[model samples]
Target chain A: MFAGLSAFPLTPLRNDEVDEVAYAGLIERLVAAGVDSITALGSTGAYPYLTTDERRRVARVALEHAGSVPVVVGVGALRTSQVIGLARDAADAGASGVLLAPMSYQPLTDDDVFGLYEDVAAAVPLPVIVYDNPGTTHFEFSDALYARIAQLPNIASIKIPGVPAEPDAARARVEQIRSAVSDRVTIGISGDASAARGLNAGCDTWYSVIGGTLPEAALAICRAARSGDAAAAMAESDRLQPLWDLFAEHGGSFRVIAAIAELGGLVTPNSLPLPVRGLDRTARDRVARVVRELGLIPPA
Target chain B: MFAGLSAFPLTPLRNDEVDEVAYAGLIERLVAAGVDSITALGSTGAYPYLTTDERRRVARVALEHAGSVPVVVGVGALRTSQVIGLARDAADAGASGVLLAPMSYQPLTDDDVFGLYEDVAAAVPLPVIVYDNPGTTHFEFSDALYARIAQLPNIASIKIPGVPAEPDAARARVEQIRSAVSDRVTIGISGDASAARGLNAGCDTWYSVIGGTLPEAALAICRAARSGDAAAAMAESDRLQPLWDLFAEHGGSFRVIAAIAELGGLVTPNSLPLPVRGLDRTARDRVARVVRELGLIPPA
Candidate 1:
């Protein structure tokens, strides 16, 4: 069911609690900006960090606020039982689909990975998206594993990483996955910097991070690629180069984007969890300048 | 307060719930084997996978069953607030110390790492053991970071990885940590294979995994090193060589040891969480053979 651009909204926090008001506003903005989907409890959402109660609350808020936009709730956990529990919670909260990742402290074999997805898919009525993020989960799925997982009932799509730093390799990798999986399972690419190249390689969707805070800018880039307008897509990607570069430099942009949202008066300050220090004054200024240049900040 | 060998007991599961009865029995075995300390919710206990209530129950059970043996509870989490919450819960359950690791889905800077420990230490009156396991947490601590963390008022000790596969390097690494931190803060080394080398390096404590399951064998190695008998330490380590080799081959012995514990009639079979598959029939047979040879199985 994943296609076009899906905005992964950051879970704004207040007083160590999920800021439902702020999250609702964020999702409303994504829907208003014409995003194809809104993903709550994603990596950007700090799904692992939040308690089970908070995840359910976030999903409810995102789904209620998302309205016309489909809301995909991330249901990844260390155990299949836990993931299935979260999947049921997501379905109960009225999420569009559940995104599952094989997250374990211990190494998992391909059979173990297959079994995890199979159990969750069987338990949940909602479509399940296999999130193949080896960088975080440390469990990479081979082509054979992907083919096997694709055969699971209710398996919807696969979200593959597109290393923005290596655009050519990113495109090739996405194309390889596109060829490996069944046609029914859509291939989506993450990593904002690789959006243009990945989409140009015919990836069906962009599971995006920056797209949450700057949906209009992200939508333009995705739309350009969807129409096979490589030049237009590259131009939009180029416009967002500074932000992508910042994300790479900092390891990730979850905190930086939260700071940006705060700076733009989108969310209250100190919305991120503890120890996730936002950009220092100088770096925040640089991000502000880039966001302003792209017309993302200052309330359009 | 950490000294000698601290056994990290695994949390046996039944029907996906923490089998407190089995856990208490495991703690009883560790105490009977004369382990110096018992860590209730350490990595081997699968603390991260358990729910907050389950962790609390496990901590209570370990402390109650541990009797005189000091119980240290692992309280690491992705959020500072959650870590502090766990620490408070640990203290209330009469845990001797709380183990804190800089766990994050996102890579953390040095400042971020220090801030996490400081906040948790200040918030909880209980002593906090800085757990530096980069392989799992993905957040490595430098000597400088260790020095900074040592300054926290309630910070008790640091549990650093001992790369059992490389004994020479492991000794050097433990020595470096000993020199970097103040003598007031104890230094405990984990990884069963590195116990003899780490203890030989004048490390204050051994935070052991296999020690919980096979405490007699682990305690023998620790006692040999503690008494300044290098030859005896290596001999004891050699006695358990097969098990260490299995751990190295399987990425970790968390599941392998779980299987061994079950085979020894310590816990019921299938105690490990799903996706964390135990050794197959053949591998289990091999582990069983090693356990039997070491006299770790066939409980007395």
Candidate 2:
């Protein structure tokens, strides 16, 4: 289920609406790069921003462009019913699975958290990947809680965001859960900065932000890591280190998708939802410089 | 703007759907208790968990029950577009204003944060109240950025969650912003525990989760505070101290909502979103005891 690199592409927007044509082009590029799966309507895709119809349109365009590639759609929402509806829409749009984040609102009890997943899992027929990004949810999944969720029939994987400060602690937590759940649940590592470490810790999948913009390089790294070619994987990772550094330098995960979109020429002066300021000239130039160094853009 | 107590009533659910009848009843209680305003679809109302239709229905029901009392609707969403849609719906539903939380993503840049508020402020015709609950969003609004956002037309107020580790720092920042922006943006403090502290910090409004269930007592506390009856406010606050303690004992915001719902007879056997472990019997009993102490339930 997790052999090749999967890309979560950013959803392009125009006039405060989904830009389907641009989104199709981005999806085609990733599929052409031999990506194993493509995720749409993810945080990268600004899933929450899109209208229900707009989200469906994006999903339709993405699935169409992806052709035979597995399309995983993000189905996170504040309400369980909305999530269920999104899950249905994703499945109808021909998605292979859905990734779910914890319901937002601080300090959700373990029961409420579990109930949300159960409601979504039961509502959608597709396999569901539980996304545990405590950074966004402000509530981390305890190992004991994750283990209980892993036992659910339709839950296929867990997406854990990599922690730069204590990579080992995160890795150990993932490994512990993986062992507890055994083959029933696969672990997917988010945060390309710690992909190598996560993979070494038995993460079955790696969802790369950089990969969405540069699938070839991301895939190569994944292939190397999978084949136990540590040197090759590290080298590829190092080559892309500048881009990762750019993501870190420009406010980490928050701006990474927009930065990638700017580099890929998918959108002009990429924007985020209100209250998110745009990157300055200096920040944009830094990204451009790294993109050129990585041969992401032709040297000029 | 910041002179009175505002209550966010629980949006009751029945069999996995919005229970509009119960919702109206809840709002009626709050209105009867002399609450200055009612906030619908706020985090306590489980705004994120309800479907759009459910949210609309609840808002309509609440507005109807609230009569001419100003109704502020929470329109926070991960996407700017969605927030705009919600703002439109809230306006149509007769809400007097909108309460918006920042986007739910990790490591949001200052630009993203600013963009979120700006977009929402621009989208809704009604005045917008920025909800700055970093405890849930994991993205705090910096003083510099909040100052800029406060300057946006239609940006009327800010709802600062009471649980920040450094409430004084937030207060200082708000004061600084207010000095720069004039009274264009009023400040509202969330969390019943810190309502008095927020008032002392020069906040314009006090919002209460406990008020969802204990409207009479909550409004009494607010009236006392607003009338400069510090002694009475403190006495009323002390009487409701058990309610605040339930929040402390249950360990988070959502739990407090669930506990209060049970005490109010608005819901039976309270539940929360999944992955969150349910409150244990001991915890539930603790909550029940507090409810009894508050005279929220008839003496056995």
Candidate 3:
């Protein structure tokens, strides 16, 4: 369950509230796509933008619609107690695991981050996926820290950012992590742009962003790579180069994926929580054009 | 209202909830100390760790006990709509101004940040303080963005991180920001250790951490600087050099200040919100010893 492709579906918001209907539909799409796992409230789900009650509901909503697939809920918060509460909520809501990121405001020390994982892990029985997305949380996880955390109770996976693009370097990075972590802990790759490279390089799973909204395209790359068809995986990834470029051209995957979800009718217009202005019309038009050109939009 | 010594009080928590009584007492202490301004919910206040209702109550408590002193409320959040709501709460709670930090979870674009200030400024009637503490928020504000956001209505100040240590360099840095921002926007210096240098360098305010708990020590620095006694200002700051070193040794001011507050019998012990482990016993002993040596603990 920890290996293979984990599709992170957008928890689309409407009227500044979780649009349950739209969110349920997005989850249903993922279930139908046969994603190995459904990770709700990952960065793509705008977890930090949500309130505790809202996050609980979103977790419950995801589990309800996730069918038989394992569901991992992102329960990262700035406070350890809050994360513990969310982790409990995820467990209560029947999530298969919880994703824990040391989300920071006042930059944390090494002990601070380690203690967060230790406390949360000790508090919850559900499996914990150590989230290492520094781009958003701005908290870098040292290798020693990773090694230390992987020994904690209920730790199931380590979701690292994109690997070094060089294939050998990526492999070295993966091996280094694999050697550090408990053998039971799977290594998952985030950063959708580098999913193929990461998977091809030895990562056991792709904890994806684009896969959240456009599962078919991501599945093409994942299936190819998982089947040992590295060239075919690269080729599949290359086919969607335009969409990847959109992610870079805009900023990160968050807004571009949001635009994709909105333009592809997976979400309502302006679906992103505020402060995050979804791409402007011109940018959205560009995203829509590329998404259409790539045939990412589902046929009605 | 945005200028002079803006003491940032700790909204100390007990048992995972805002310790409102302890909080109100902290505010009263600041009021009695006659701080130039009381900034509730600043980084030292652990605003990001708090819930909206907790934040609202903290703001109201500060205002209620602040006597005639101006109370600047930190209303920063990850979401724009949430900030808008908090800014409204600040206004309704009778805040003198709102301190707006571009708090990030998903790394934000310059446009996204500017739009946040634009939206919040439009939605609130109170003055706004542009809080540029990259140490906590991890969102760097460029001079161009500062110049841009400072132009928005109700922008009363820009609270920047510590300036360059060198007097000439600090002055130049201050001058550069002064040149960029609107004449109405005062340039306040955070980073308590650099308050004297920044204030002597022509920055308008000291948005201080220690000031919230040990107001007299900060007042000495603030008063000497404001009175143009540059040598005296530096000397007074030098007096607390021991405390400042603790801040550096501890990685940041948040935990150190919480330690000070707890040792001085201001807040209950273990006062900070969770995930943020307050200073360990050894560190707290060091903090307590420094507080005693510096004469920061007020007479019983």
lDDT of model 1 at residue A277? 76
lDDT string for model 3 (B241-292, tens) is: 9988998998888888888888778888889877778888898888889888
Candidate 2 lDDT tens digits, A216-261: 7778888888888866777777777777777777656546557657
Cα TM-score of candidate 2: 0.89
Q: What would the per-residue lDDT of candidate 2 be over residues B1-300, giving only the tens digit for each residue? A: 334778877666666667777778788777777778888888777776666777788788888889768899988776666778889999998889988887566466666767777777776789888788776667777667777888888988878776343547756855765786647578777878877656655667887786676776667777776677766776777777767776777665567667557654666544444334446778777777877667776211
Q: How accurate locally is residue A271 in candidate 1, as Cα lDDT from 0 to 100?
A: 85
Could you report the Cα RMSD, in angstroms, for every candidate shown?
1.9, 3.6, 1.9
Top lDDT prediction, candidate number: 3
Per-model lDDT: 0.85, 0.73, 0.89
Evaluated on CA atoms against the true complex, candidate 3 attains a DockQ of: 0.71
If scored against the real structure, what TM-score would every candidate get?
A: 0.96, 0.89, 0.95
lDDT of 1: 0.85
Candidate No. with top TM-score: 1
Off by over 4 Å in 3: B298-300
TM-score of chain B of each: 0.95, 0.89, 0.98
